[model samples]
Target: MSLVELIAQADERGLAAAGVSCLDRCVPLLGGDDEVLRPLWASLAEDGDGWGERVAKIRGHACDAATGAGAEAVSGPRSGPGAEAEAALLARRMLAAVPAERSAGALREWADTCSVAALDIHRLLDVADDGNTSVTDCREGRTEGMPPLVTAELRRQVTVLELLAGHGAAGVRQALEVSAEGRRVLQAVVSRRARGRT
Candidate 1:
């Protein structure tokens, strides 16, 4: 199903998880630890109020990490010039994208924005640099190419929304699992970049 159609049918819980999952996948861009967003996921799983607090904590951590002063030191150090500042800026945008309250409209907006932002952040962090270039080019009537990694991410995002639309609350667990898979993919990408730096 199309993202708009899926979002139009999602309930509040599905919408909330959709937004959180997007941020969760892009945590590495913030220089955040792998588990930093775990509590937010837990809150969604339990349908509790703790997600707000967890988001706050993550925002602070992301800010510090981007400045090279994280409480939990980042690995290998960001060697690219201005990369830290760029990561921090993207992190801020991610946090801001979270809806202030639970509503399908709000969550849909957040999810849509995150989809584009996460792709941009990944492109910025990718060693290859060509991964998302064609996506932009395609939009500009210049090229039809999209890197496989980016294509997979976009597919996963659409699938999550579709699952939520199809099964409502019952689909939450499956959606979370899909989000986790995306996170693992991004984590592997981060690790690969780290290894290449040495």
Candidate 2:
């Protein structure tokens, strides 16, 4: 069964039987590769339309599963009377199964670096996705006359990316570079839009 199917069935059966109150406990059993249910995702991914979203979800769930498994390795079905222990065990296995490489370290690093600045990579992603590069109202194409907040945020993001440019996370740094490029692109688009608007 696929991870989604397993989760849906468990939800249908109810949390009492599923013992899945939190994402931590719920994700371990998501259908995928042999023991991991990862394979199921690959099959689903072959469809391709919602690939990035699906993959993001899969990776997030996998990370959650690793956390669940680390809490406890549930051997059998929990449903009903045996739910608490089963939940704990499930969490253990889920937590344990997550590999260290799949976004965890980089995300942790990124989050840590950006925490003080409050300009997380996720925020960078939001900017990239939303097509906003305005130093003032990023989404609104208000670049030439950006507010203090937007410019500060942009500068902070740029600084962090520059810092992370080296280190071991080349891919992450590459993404940062891409987002920086995006900011430049957005600046241009917003400039054009602003010129048109004005």
- Which candidate number has the best lDDT? 1
Candidate 1 residue pairs in backbone clash: none
Residues 1-198, model 1: lDDT tens digits: 445455556677766776777787877666767677676667666766765677677667766765552223234434453443454466567776676555568776776667666656655565555533754442233434555566666677677777766776577778878888888888787667557657
lDDT of each: 0.64, 0.32
TM-scores for the candidates: 0.72, 0.20
**Candidate 1 stretches greater than 4 Å from native:** 48-51, 69-88, 125-144
In candidate 2, residue 124 scores what lDDT?
Answer: 31
Give, for candidate 1, the lowest lDDT window spanning 10 residues: 69-78
The count of backbone overlaps in candidate 2 is: 28
